[model samples]
Target: MSVIWKGVFPAVTTKFNDNDEMDFAAFDKNIEAQLEAGAKGIIIGGSLGEASVLSDTEKIELLKQTVKTVNKRAYVILNIAEQTTKAALLCAENALKYGADGLMMLPPLRYLADKHETLEYFAAVAKSTPLPIMIYNNPYDYKIEVTLDMFEELSKYENIQAVKESTRDVSNVTRMINKFGDRFKLMTGVDTLALESIFMGAHGWVAGLVDAFPRETVAIFNLAKQGRHEEALKIYRWFLPVLELDIHPKLVQYIKLAETQTGLGTENVRAPRLPLVGEERTRILAIIDNAIANRPELPAGSWGVEA
Candidate 1:
């Protein structure tokens, strides 16, 4: 439970092969790149990971793989987006057994839980595990906002230490800070708004585009944290177009394609999510490739491994 719950934690995409099987080798490469770029943790089986199609066993296996791949270099957090509190508890419990350091938990999906129900569900899972939890409050997408009042109640659980804040409204960052102060560490979840969120007092980023451009993502946060706003903004501007990909419905496909272009991963996503094709594919590639061509140079100092 000693996780920092800050910095660039990638909501990683689950790497698959053309056969649609889990491709650990491809997965490992991207992970190595993440670590090298100084990600704070690895959030597996998130929306970006194609979590819905992955079975429970597969999720567990993914956790095991991440724990091994990370090798104590960073935190390995499993995303729990289940339909029932019972199932989420089971997932969180299993995550602890497999060496996960923390969890990025959403409200019970499929049901669109109301406030009381959402609070109860989160409480059940929070009390179920000793591992620290970062409750994901993304109302726009998930249809459940873990409001300040809800957090006031959940704050009783010591392990519920952080939040993946994706409310889309930057002002909410200040509101949370105004009420809760330091009770919950905040990590921004949206890629497009990440730099602004961080400047507004978000402690870290549960980043999406980091799957492909880990260095730039990490550098933005690292530099901004150091009060190098001018430098951070420079990279963020060049990064804007590519960062928008994370907000798309086909984000998994879009990011995987970016990974392939970067030599960090492949474009193979799980089924029901076919690889991006035709005009859409061409359009997305234009954005990614264009970013690649005009990528900015980070400050030549020790930001991380290569700095």
Candidate 2:
């Protein structure tokens, strides 16, 4: 069967109530909104969803809730990135049981792991699940680099089917496409570089900011797929700055704040992560507000449409 994960799949946000508890209702609403707004599928419990702070019970409950809410309208992917293969395997098994379309995993991050350790971790997790798996290789955030050769080597696993290449290095993507071709699905984890990736032969994009602007992100992929690069690049340039914040160390905070300002989602993130404030917060808010205010009056999927 073909992979169910192609196109604009947003790394969804996990909503919390005023009491700082998981708001099942709000989370439910957000899922429906994204699907209705034309998202191809939705990703849960990733960096955008604050997967690190959530407990195992929380992850399971959220996955169950997501299944119940989305039903079968859109693809549901569980992001189960952990430092240990044990955790990743358990999470993948549970996710598969709950009807997740696929699994996305990040590399071991607590300690610096060698190429051998990393490959073994993925192989173990791949064997643990029946579902297809996507390796989330974001070297920028983890400071752990996965060389093209290492990635090429790991793609041999039966279930290790896709790579979320977030390094934004064009050459890296080019090499992967040249070496692997259709053997492994290559998706861009960085939104700003998404168009370039498509032109270079990426299968899809795993976007964090899609929660706020589904139409824009979806347009980039759809347009480029149709060979409408001139049109796609325009929206790419417009959405670039706002999308850059998603890669920042303070990504969750800025995203939460932007959601609040847009009436899209809440700004209430769990502690150890605080709300944006002072000049930095102000600058960020202004950046988002200005984008929205100055945003062109384009129709849905207009990013792909010519002016």
Best by lDDT: 1
Spell out the clash pairs found in candidate 1. none
RMSD of each: 1.3, 2.4
The sequence of per-residue lDDT tens digits that candidate 2 reaches over residues 141-210 is 8877778788778876777888888876867788887887787788888876777888888878888777
Q: lDDT of each prediction vs. the true structure?
A: 0.90, 0.80
lDDT of 1: 0.90
lDDT of 1 by residue, 1-307 (tens): 6789778999899988778889999899999999988887999989999999999989989999999999999999999999988789899989999999999899989897788999999989988889899999999888999888999999999999999999999989999999999999999999999999999999999999999999999999988888889999999999999999988889889999999898989988777788888999999999999999998888865246422
User: Candidate 2: minimum summed lDDT over ten consecutive residues — where?
Assistant: 298-307
Error of 1 at 130 (Å): 0.6
